[model samples]
Target: MTSLTIIDLSNNRFSGPIPPNIGESIPNFLYSLLSNQITGIIPKSIGYMSHLEILDLSRNSLIGSIPSFISNYSYLYFLTLEKNNLSKTIPKSFG
Candidate 1:
């Protein structure tokens, strides 16, 4: 499970906060959970995934300010958090 990568659970009815330690659970991956029934705030722990390249958590019921740590993905090329309940401007480090 630790070596896992590329999780795509889109277009499902999965409801719940994303697994609390998903960042540490899958340290290197392209994660996507689009268009689901997921709710709650995006976890700050996702910042620990230094190897993440692509992440899409859009169109869910996610709430709260987008974690400022999202900018930690140095190798991330694509990311999408749209259609969610995120607020607070993106971190300047996102640049």
Candidate 2:
């Protein structure tokens, strides 16, 4: 999985919180879990994926503020998190 560059699991009808160790398993350039039943905070370990360029967790049941470390992804250019229960203003560095 270390060689993987993208992962898209959108609209799979999957449920449950995203595994906290996902970043350790697949540090890819793009990740998407859109339109699922996923609930819980966006895993902080995702910040470890320095090469991440696109992330889409939209239309899920996720809750919690967007992690601050997301702003550290210099390569991240596309992010879609709409329709979730996330709170708080986005990190200033992200904009």
Candidate 3:
């Protein structure tokens, strides 16, 4: 859905990695995958979401360092990755 603005799948207990091409598929403004069983790294293609404003992936099983490209989102205002297994320090340029 090119016109979609939000995708909230919070607390759904879903597992698995985020789709690698989600940004090219939906490019929504808000995306929430909170409180799930999701695993794996955040896809790099998510950086292609030009209109993205909010992203929440809390309480999941994600790993790897946060992508540095996330700081390029000029429209992003809210982001949360708490309670997950992500490692490494947040990118210095991130807000």
Candidate 4:
């Protein structure tokens, strides 16, 4: 969120689980948080955001399990966590 590069703090009341120093203060930025009230998990340094391409955390209250280091983001296209409260078992390279 430093100087901004597409950060849309979705609904608001942003909670935890997205820290990991957050690219050490915007080392080149990119973000789009969708529908907030964000809870936990999904921050393994966000695979070091290699010029991240569109990650929309759809409707939030995020629980755990979704971070297989985000498949190491091969220039992620569009990842939307449809209706949160994340349960688990999605990571076999996301089936």
Q: What is the lDDT of candidate 4?
A: 0.71
In model 1, state the lDDT of residue 93. 82
lDDT scores for all predictions? 0.86, 0.91, 0.91, 0.71
Clashing pairs in 2: none
1-95 per-residue lDDT for model 2 (tens digits):
77899899999999999999888778899899989999988988887889999999999999999899888988999999999999967989877
C-alpha RMSD between model 2 and the true structure:
0.8
lDDT of 4 at 93: 69
User: How far in Å is the alpha carbon of 80 misplaced in model 1?
Assistant: 0.4
Best by TM-score: 2
Model 2 worst lDDT run, 10 consecutive residues: 86-95
Cα deviation of 19, candidate 3, in Å? 1.3
Task: Tell me the spans in candidate 2 whose CA falls farther than 4 Å from its real position.
Answer: none
Q: In model 3, where do residues sit more than 4 Å from their true spots?
A: none
Q: After superposition, how far is residue 54 of candidate 1 from its true place, in Å?
A: 0.5
lDDT of 4 by residue, 1-95 (tens): 54566776777868767776675565434476788777786666666776776788888777877878666666777788988877756767642
Can you write out model 1's per-residue Cα lDDT over 1-95, one digit (the tens) per residue?
Answer: 77687789999889999878877767766989999989998887788888889989999989998788788778889989999988957878896
Q: How does model 2 fare in lDDT?
A: 0.91
